[model samples]
Target chain A: MTVERSAPPTISEVAAEAGVGRATAARTLGGYGYVSPELRSRVLAAAERLGYRANALARSMSTGVSHTLGVIVADIGNPFFAGVVRGISDASRARGFDTIVLSTHESLDEEIAAMHVLIDKQVDGIVVASAALGPKTSAHIAEAWSRGIPVVLVDRAVPGLELDAVVIDNREAAREAVTALIAAGHRRVGFVWGPPIAGRPDRRRDLVDAAARNLWTDGERLRGYLDALDDAGLPFDADLVMVGEKTEERAIAEVERMLGLDDRVTALFCTETDAVTGALRAIRATGFRVPADVSLIGFDDSSWAAVMEPPLTMIEQPMLALGTRAAEVLLALIDGAPRSQPDGAFRHTLDTRLVERSSVAPPSA
Target chain B: MTVERSAPPTISEVAAEAGVGRATAARTLGGYGYVSPELRSRVLAAAERLGYRANALARSMSTGVSHTLGVIVADIGNPFFAGVVRGISDASRARGFDTIVLSTHESLDEEIAAMHVLIDKQVDGIVVASAALGPKTSAHIAEAWSRGIPVVLVDRAVPGLELDAVVIDNREAAREAVTALIAAGHRRVGFVWGPPIAGRPDRRRDLVDAAARNLWTDGERLRGYLDALDDAGLPFDADLVMVGEKTEERAIAEVERMLGLDDRVTALFCTETDAVTGALRAIRATGFRVPADVSLIGFDDSSWAAVMEPPLTMIEQPMLALGTRAAEVLLALIDGAPRSQPDGAFRHTLDTRLVERSSVAPPSA
Candidate 1:
């Protein structure tokens, strides 16, 4: 250590200066459990005198629980994830837990590495919006479970992993959103979404299974759209379903492709916030009006969506509830609750609401 | 611990199964140092057969370096902060480091607690967008330095603590922004911002010193605004400065208060993204047009600012650069680089530029 940098005053120094037992001094300074005001003040005064301060890391090593939760999200730049993180933080703090948040940026490899980092940090439990890691590539997650650390899934659940998950009913709500647009007399509607990973052919030709192999969320949303088309007695125009990368620029490109189709989409159903924003920019750039030129319904309501020229109609996922519930389940598991059968993981699916704003109207005849 | 849940097969089991020395098995399995392909594959196959996996915690205990960086920000919901975090994560990953990001939500206690949590986690270094902790309450920070962990400040520097900081020339940027509006012939302008703290007695006759105690970032911005007024020979009207909590609702309320001023301000200057958004909503709600009715300029350019009916002309902070630079500096310090003199800390001031779009005009003259 450098000579100019003297040692930081320790808990022992404060304890000795306050003339109290180490445990009492700790209770006074750590802000955990209980300590008498008189003792607290004495310890605080001594800490002030000797320059002793609270050291949470030291306490964690002794207590075995770091009082911190690790949260791994798909992306932090996305406002939807931001809302969920805020919800998690709000609930976590209320329950005396701090959160260590990491963004995977939608990479399975990054997600696995992040989980390892979180485990090293010794977070009590983890809540992740995973990258849909396949069973063959999921050793890190299984490792977490094997070590007795709880894990909760948010937004999307992996098919092979038996884990607690909190999610909104993506399929049903997506179908409802599309149905509403169909009811508004749109025969040609385009669905813009990210194609989940490929290579695993659905052995079971079931719609649910087909969707599950892709992103659990995207699959459900797609299934709902497909089911809505069937209910409306509309043909499943594969050309109208734009399955490509899930990025703002990619969404715009898909939209442009849909516009150039022989049966140009009269209505667009966007499945993410970035897609919606990008679609809006594309529509404006093409010299088209919102409802007047292209009716639209988007996913995940935002403050900006509300303030847009014509407020957007969106399927509002209960974002905060998803995060809070995930944390709740993970905490329960961490607090010694027995894990149910691997086939019977605790899964909570919240409902989403269609917020009807001015962005959608009857399609042109 | 349960009868049905057997203990995870340990490293020893894998080593024995692999028919290799413990150290060789460890190297092969841990992805550290060097191991031949044949040995690595053998060890991996044996570990797979035994359902054995590496534990990062065990590794961290031995190495004493978590290979993770802790970043504590004031607020994660703020887009400006979110951009900074994304930059930090990008830079961290590029250098084979992972970040454990924590949000203090502007609470000093939370920041301090977060610091302890990170320290306990054994992170290599820390980068903090500190809450500008008061001198009397900042021993926790000093303690970290005493323990030989480096901390780098972003956006604001603590006056009492000598630490490396990455910042923009907030005062100059503010003055230039305000000067632009002033030069546009707007004599009466509303300055909307969040008050530093609720109970701070700003009884000091000097405005420069008054703002410093609240937050370094806010104080510098405030000082710049005052300097602009002083330079332009305009009177400093305290009533024109709306100081309240920094939230959308509070901003709306403050804007309403400004509109109700005896000499209602002609134009508005917002100091944050939420404030800018709220001000826009308020203006729209009041049936006022941008530049035509109330010329406006906002701090922290945003995506929504571009999509607005009249694109906003505002100051753009190099948010990503701020995070990247701070992390880079801290990483340098962590690499055993000699510490510079405490009084001459490594200070980086990135430039802020005015992005002029269509939001500003000659005050309707």
Candidate 2:
């Protein structure tokens, strides 16, 4: 069957017909950034006459604005990314920008591929909840930056990337959680993390010093954990920490392994949404009640946490607010705002509050 | 600061360097459809020298092949959409197409705006879990088709659009749920739905004929609910059905109203994920233990449902399968495969099995 399709009128044609610069014509037609009322109407009138369209792609190529923000996140399976993306959606839409959501699934290669697509597609800017990046993997970000597309980091920031970022005070939050467990008379607090899984390249046994460079943001969290241990004069036990490899199933298996140990953990500190779910599932699988059997403190609050059997105690990072702030900063960059004013304001370390719920309690005698 | 950047090489440049047709170059670059070994190697070699990129966008405009599939969903907040999207992502990636995800948030205007973005972005095709389209609103779908972009519907098919769709037999699923409740000796069962909320179009006080055209697959589910009541020789109570408007707050309020009524409902059949959460929350708020105080059945089983206090008795739709089938059909359409064989296969209605859990029991005295 021969389906009838018309060749879409390009922006060059529209600009030529409007007798205006391609950028101005696109600004009016795409309904983004700024354009004068008089020129906007002229472009509209010409566009109507010529049956010109608001083709964001073609206009992006010509006028260098797509009005679409690229969002490359680390994990979509985790509900945490959904919340962050929702915030991006709200802010982007309110700013007349659409969002192109992609997930890295915790892989640097996938992240690079997605960035290529976004850069080639000509997005206005990007908000990256990036995965742990290895050294020498800076080409894609540099490529995007070279193309004048600003990158705003959210949730997890790459180590050496000098990009504006919105992140929770991970070390402090982790310390508070661990300290809370310690104050409750718990000496053996287990820690479950996303990456640096067993046999991974980044895993350095015996609690690597906070000064050391590595993949994954767990370094800060791990540092906080060590700080709490030192404050209470409790010896650090490396066996209590499990690397989840960014999957619920693997996390669950690791948690189960910890539970089966000769000296099992008394309290659990999960450092991500998937880790929390996996830990909870594993606890349930072991026929153990939360708080009663093993007190737990989870990072990144999700709706499931509130509705869990014994509502979970978690670190509630201001996710939506972080997204909003990141977008605002990104928008400013896109609008040609100076990188640093005289005051030099840059990194936004949003505070994470511990939501005290029924998941934690004093250890049983 | 001025950023020094050069325009990325286009596919035409790659094709020319490869000394092959655009189709052959695209086939090798996109990693889709089929390509011969020799031509693929030649294209790769040319891409390496010219730094020839896939660049879905430029390739889309020049060669009419944007290796990107647009996904416009209704509610990304709901886990249902997340599952469907995961399936879409999996299938699309495996088939060498990147997905661009968008949401309508249950608003027609937002839905229209999203479609405009997707269409203007020049996606290879679209899979829309469309919002309820009011009359005189078929223009955008028509516009996309006229532009040679095929759309496949998932979750629910828009009425009057002859687009290929993958949906569950919602009516049958609802009837089965209601029938199960009846068999459990519950006559005062309630139902909570998403759309057709107060003062909106398609708000028929009485159950409308099955032939009626409207949005959302709820109509079928509603019909099945009514059929179950009729089969059991019970009088239909309009009061038992509440319109949620697709938000947990509204659904919770409506559920609270049902609980506050002089003739309170003993059981609820929540028709969506948000409705289930709202109903569960309301039940908890009222200090009512599920299955003991009020037996409940929910649609679209979520992780929360599985971990609920008493778990939950709910309908588990093949959401991932629905997304997979939709993508498959869309790919076929994109490949210009024949619309039909001798059997005239088109609509794919996946099964919804009832997961029997502890949330349903005999009505209390």
Candidate 3:
């Protein structure tokens, strides 16, 4: 049998049922201009009886406020993003706003498409964990800003775009993690995961040149690794660093290569979750033990990290707080709050915590 | 300085620029009906020059097809739901649809609000992992159905709703897990998670009564536990069961109590992610070694499960497949696919796999 449905009741019908002018009914139902309490009650009662649900699209078009927040994240499946989205959604809902989430899956084309869709849908604001590396790649985001749709960046920032961003001090966090490794007598430390630059960086200058072409976060992290090496008065060795596409398989291969080197890395500084997993898998396959043959430190403390064989020391980014603060900032902007910065960009950097577990130790003699 | 934004360009302006009639421009720009190739190119180029974006809301209102999907999950932060949402989003995007995700945080009031918001937004269809357990609690879903909006359930099913549902055979999966524990020579096994029923269930009949008030999935799982007990010619002992709010803290307290029992359980079956974490914490706190003191089985395999000291045996649900199939079915329903079931409710059950790792062993004599 076919499903039969009637057309939704309109404002005119509700007004007729309530014995009030259409304007009064529209004002009451649309929640716009003033209506007397008695007339408002009649209109609402009429709407209830007639089952009149306001057309959110039409209402948004008329008022120019959809009361909706759109989020464009790289991957909703990642635990980091999952936590952030939860924070954003919770805050948005508490503020009487609805949220529309779109995952880009780390594709620039998809990110562009998502931005256009959110704009066309007239979302009041957008919070993005951009996969974009430069201004040209983030043209859609800039376009959104020009269109008066507020955009807030999370996790990463783009150069040359003046907008609000919520992020952690990636450079400082990375330096501290790597510095701890160095202080533990790990002269030969391997860095895994970074921007996928073309070819390998054979020297320190090569890395410096590649930094300008990668994600701002990755560049900061690479610089932090360099800072630690420089502070220890150790010469940079290309063989001890793995910087490229961060797939687990690629990480495993690069780590194994480092392990097989004549001057093998005695410790590892993994910059991401997948990097840590890959390094552990490689160590296991190569007949090495964590914190024994080689000590390790990873970014992103996760549930699994606590339950690992010897537990894992990690740098925990405040993912939930990042999302919540971004929403708060964006909502304030939408509410006509003045920018605190002269250039119209507000950068909020949160602190990361280092949780020391069983994964770190002095390098084996 | 203040931001100045111009009003968006209109279709009429686009038509004028393209030197075509309003109808021709509308046909070309709206992607409806037909337009000549020459006129289509002109309208397209003119629209691009004007930087015009078709109002997706208006287009949806006129066409009655939003080309959007709305997803309401219990919690997007949960890895299971996160994976499911990614699968749904990927599948939806491949089919040229955008998805709007909302998290209810397991609150029925929020679920109802989310349903109303999605309906008001005029999404083409909805896929929900409903937090509502009964007909009364799910009136919004039924209302959406009555309003000619199609909805597909994921993860959980409502008892009286006649709608498509995608789920695993939770009962069989639970029974398989429990039966494995029994076969391993553990006579006293504790079931660590289920629906929140008031007061204590002192006998097996009370459990049967409580099943009617809980979630359908929980009821099935509880029945599966009972089936395993019956099959093994074992008496149902209320002391060996913990059924309530399924919170991590609650699970920890309950498991600790079980561990303190005079006739303590030799094995435990934890039904969810939080339950597993809580059980592990309780065992560690009580100084009870895994396998040696209490064998354990858990549901939902995760990254940490593989890296745990003794690892974890888990029942792995096809979470991603469940979401993909839900979207496929909902899209089909939206596209006018006929229901194959006589009752107009199509149910698809995916298989669950039992991954045996190092967590289970014969209980100590």
Candidate 4:
């Protein structure tokens, strides 16, 4: 090999400087097979002195451990995902690992591509807030697992996948939020966001069927909304629930149509940040007042929520905790920890807190 | 070598199945040395049939190109950086490249460690919003460049480093914002969030000296503030400037202190998101009204700013463009494009839009 002092020092140069065999130096620096303590120290010291850094790819190929975690989220620009990524990065860094984050823009095809990339890179583990919902859609994830790279799901869970998951009790959280609206004497409550249904639901069964075919979180939250209506002995009004693609523009149009109905929605339950913002904009455009003409409750509290006209009452998800727990679980699996439950999965259901400010009140006459 | 049917296919297995030599298979699959079109197609077809995937680590070692990029930012949780990352990720994905993101929390040591990790990963290039300042603090970046991995900076630039940088003209942005406040007939304008300095400054020279030792954006913005004051022939009042750690609590406390000063500040210019939030909270807590009691102008517009009681006027940064331009420059470099400028560096200065809302009004006597 050519000895070029200007380029980064090679392993052979490090070995020569350490007065050890190249094989020993490779084993010590690559963190694979055994090397005597003395020889390891000598090689490490020589590496530091020569500014020699081991290539992670070569090391990963030999040891099957990249000391890196891969995270795939829907969109990193969204505040919720941003917080979750921060938690995962902080937790992973503290545990002596690096993280690679990829955003799929909620596309299944992109998610598949990202999964393939992660597997090719040989990450030690993965934490995913998956866009895939069922077994067929999640074949890429299963392929990664079969290759021995464990994956931990966060924010959402997939059916028929026996893997550790960190998520909030979406059903219970939605139930509690809707129950509060009912307790405030609201007979007509609107659900502003739900699963990506193909058409508007004209009956309760339509929602139930759509939920079954979509994401686990969406299905659970829809059930929670239905539960609250049942608890109040109120009939589920299909017109009061917004369906189809959950976009801000669609949310505003749907909310406007609902408000203009012969029987108006007395209050609204929004399950996401964009939904809340869209709802507020619609309310303002329709010349309605909050907690007076229409009471509102939203999910995912932010700094702006606290500074709104009357402030906002929100259900705050444990976003950071979800991310931290996912990383921790993935790291444990990477260390060869056995699954604790009989189903061979670790289900960590975190709690969400209701922050009551001034936005919720009795429905106006 | 022994082969197992249950395991992922190996290169050797692909070579045997394709009726080619091992070296030919390696060259074809690893995307390195040239192979005849006939043999290359045969190897690729065989690999596809056997579900053989190329390991990025092994391929990178052979070809010196991972087709991946590394990004280092202050915090992924922050809205500004979140938008920037989204742009970078989207742009990189369009070019068929994967990105690895890391957050430094504005810590120099963490930035250094992140740089080292990226180098070891053998990424084709890096895009960074650096936490390092002068040559002493920026040695790690230079080292990476010298080793053939190009780095493109975004958001902030470092002095004495000849490298491509994507940034807004921060000095001009701040100057225009401050000039707007002055045009509103406000002479005593408070400048919130400056460089992190020790002890309170009693003279303009103190701030000038501190700027030289801190971040490039901070220094430029500070210079712009000074420029606006000079244009109005207003004597620089050190008492109106808030320095040191730019935390939310400090911003609130300093604004409160400024309002209570013998020569009260008639308007406030906040240079960051947190500063604006803190200033608003302080104004509310002090029983002062925005615009009527004190006019405000802030940097970095967000959705919350538009939804405020009286919509805020802000300097809207090209956050996404910054990331996109940085990625484009880095990609060009990775593709061996020559620098356009004679100085051997690409300096992309994007413009900022000044969105005038209802936040500014004539200050009350």
Every model's TM-score on chain B: 0.82, 0.79, 0.85, 0.85
lDDT of 2 by residue, A2-59 (tens): 2233745545556777789877775676555577888888888878777765566766
Q: Look at candidate 2 and give me any clashing residue pairs.
A: none
lDDT scores for all predictions?
0.77, 0.76, 0.83, 0.84
Q: Model 1 reproduces what portion of true contacts?
A: 0.40
lDDT per residue for candidate 4 within B133-235, as digits (tens), equals 7667888888677556889889988765778889999999999999999999999999888767757777787786686566788888888899999999998
* Model 4 lDDT per residue over A102-213, tens place: 8888888888888877877778899999877777688787777756678888998876677788999889999999999999999999998866776777778778778757
True contacts kept of each: 0.40, 0.36, 0.42, 0.43
* Deviating ranges (above 4 Å) for candidate 2: A1-56, A132-135, A194-196, A199-215, A340-345, B1-56, B194-196, B199-214, B340-345
lDDT of 3 by residue, A51-151 (tens): 78667666676566888899999888888898888888878888988888888888888888888778767789999999787676887887776556788
Look at candidate 1 and tell me the lDDT of residue A199: 34
Measured by DockQ, the strongest candidate is 4
Error at B57, model 2, angstroms: 3.7
Better of 1 and 2 by lDDT: 1
A best-first ranking of the candidates according to their TM-score comes to 4, 3, 1, 2
Model 3, B90-149: lDDT tens digits are: 788879988888888888888888887787777889999997776778888877765557
Q: Model 1 over residues B1-365: C-alpha lDDT tens digits?
A: 11123656755567788888776776665545677899888888888877774565545544546678889998887878888888888888889889888898888889998887777676888888888655566776765664556788888877666677788888899899889889988888777774544443343234445456667887888888878888899987766676656678877777777776777777888888777878877777877778787888889887667766677898998989988888888889889876546674557889999999887787654
Clashes of each: 0, 0, 0, 0
lDDT measured at residue B178 in model 1 versus the true structure, 0 to 100: 87
DockQ, per-model, please?
Answer: 0.25, 0.22, 0.28, 0.29
Scored against the true structure, residue B69 in model 4 reaches a CA lDDT of: 89
How would you order the candidates by lDDT, starting with the best?
4, 3, 1, 2
